[model samples]
Target: MLNKKQTNTIEVSSDIAQVIQDGQQLVAYMAKDGQVSLDPDLAQVMIDAKYKLQKKQWNAQDEAHFLHSYDQLAKAVAPVSMESIRAISRSDNDKPSQAEKAVAWYRRYTLVALICLLFVQVYYLFGHALAHDLKDLYESRNEWHLKLDSEEPNSKEFKQIQSKYEEVGQRLDANYNLLKVWNRIWLMGFSFGSEIPPYSQEKLNVELRRLERAQADANALDNLNLAQTRLTARLQLFENMLFAQSVLEVLQGYVLPLLYGLLGAFIFVLRDLLREIRAITFTTDSEIRYRLRLTLGALGGMIIGWFLNPQELSGLASLSPMAMAFLMGYNVDVLFAIMDQIIDKLRGAMAANDGSKGKSIQGSGNG
Candidate 1:
């Protein structure tokens, strides 16, 4: 129990052979219970008398001295409220950068790159697919020619025509081939400003001659009709395929990965984002949840897109290669649009909030 009027004495061993009167400024404070005490060196700074006398004895306001410094600490600490305020002010002024700005820039760049990469990766794969489709079309046309050679198209209906041929197969393979060739030539021109490959020149020359003359004596010329039709169809398919191939080559080689790099930036940025979230909060639940959801959604869409495989679908359903191409193009367009929109939305969501500022504000307030 403490009594307000009582001045409790702290027993000091007066056994110092003799008191150094000069150092008498040092005082001891005893608690109201009389037994509890702290030495000046170990005491709460507010009660150190030696430091106080040291301040009072010094005439220099700019003491530039440890004695004055000790007294100043004692004086400042004597008032708890002032001490608290000074602490807060110091905290407000002190700022160690968290590297968040750099991280944010990385995130932004990554997001932008993700979009470009999405288009790029899709284009790359689509181009590879297109080249494969072109090859298939060419080979199929060759097979058709062999079939034509084997079959007698008179009287009896053509077996495969009756069964496999349809509205799709009706499109001219020759025209498609021509279109593909022209595209290839244009691509070559763009790349090196050079002529197209000479590999198919002989076939191209023969096809051109037949095309020029096939217009005359339509019925009498019918003897060579099947051969011309087969050749022309092959040309058409080749043309269309060549164009698609060239486009894919450019996109895949030059554009896709470049864009992917951007997306990879996003991928990397997001990783850091999650790390930041975890670092700040000491938890990964939110980041993991969002990332899992995002990954699953993207994977599901890719799988769904794969279901629209043009090759098997075209073959089984009796669609022409041209029609199949159109169908695939349309489907891919729709899918790309959907995926793009979803990505845009996700990035928008991610960009919405800045959580770091709020944490700093609270820290400052505490300080």
Candidate 2:
């Protein structure tokens, strides 16, 4: 009976034989002398077959066959001029170097960011347009007259109405202003929700009656009702516009940034997965190390994006554009760094506060 090693060798031999049989046509085509020219079709087939074989576990015999077949095909096609070789759009063997991969990833994310920025630009445009529309709506003689009659411009009641109106308009405009890049960038939103009129006739009438009482304008009651009704309609439109803008902000701000962050994290982690899991702090494998660095850098970029994104009170009201997306995709690391600093500051403040409290207690005990 054969020993274990001997049995394994026999099995390997059988596998090699089977491979050889399977690749009979490939071998025959390559080995044929003066019969098969390096025709483009044959070249393609040889390359394909060679790639498939390389993917499998090959014994010495299989390796030998591969080398021989490859050499034969190479020699067969040697006479074919380089100019005659058609450029293949893509190939499995065409593995890009680290630098090439980096450039490719950078470009890909940059392009994605640009697209997001474009969407943001449109969003801002919508905002600016909406602002203008609202102004126009409020500017009509009937609308203006009703507002004027309800309360004097300088009066507290009139001021309250003006304040509320300006607050909404300014919120929209402030978002646009904050979003501007070098005082030039702007954006807009796509209305994504159904328009629902906020004020019913009964609601408007009640509100108008209250306004009439505030002004005691029994003579202008009819005009005030009409003007208030119009105002309600405009406010409803404003709400719809804001809803649409918020949806886009969530997509561009939260969803896109999160996806980008996850992508970068996964890519970086996958590159050094084995080594990272293996606990090899000092890596000897240059390829693995390089991949790890590349992925980590990408993830870092994503973190920075999150940090830079407006987290201020007015951030939600701001436009989410392609520029922000690009920043988020490429500078995610910066964002993380900022968050780390904030956390550290908070920790320090808490420690100081605790120390102060301890001192106070000590002083009290001494007294």
The number of the candidate with the highest TM-score is 2
lDDT per residue for candidate 1 within 258-307, as digits (tens), equals 34333433454356555643333212343454344344333333333333
Q: Which regions of candidate 2 are displaced past 4 Å?
A: 1-113, 140-325
- Backbone clash count for every predicted candidate, in the order shown: 25, 30
- Compute each candidate's TM-score over C-alphas: 0.34, 0.36
Query: Tens digits of per-residue lDDT for model 2 on 1-367?
Result: 4364344332244554454444444345335533444555545545554554555433455456555665565565444211112121123577653334443654575467446645655665665565555445445434544675788778888877676666655654554343332122213433323333465656666867787678866667777667765665555555554654565456554554444544444444344443432232222243455455445544554444444545452753374533344344343455556678889999999999999999999999999
lDDT of each: 0.44, 0.50
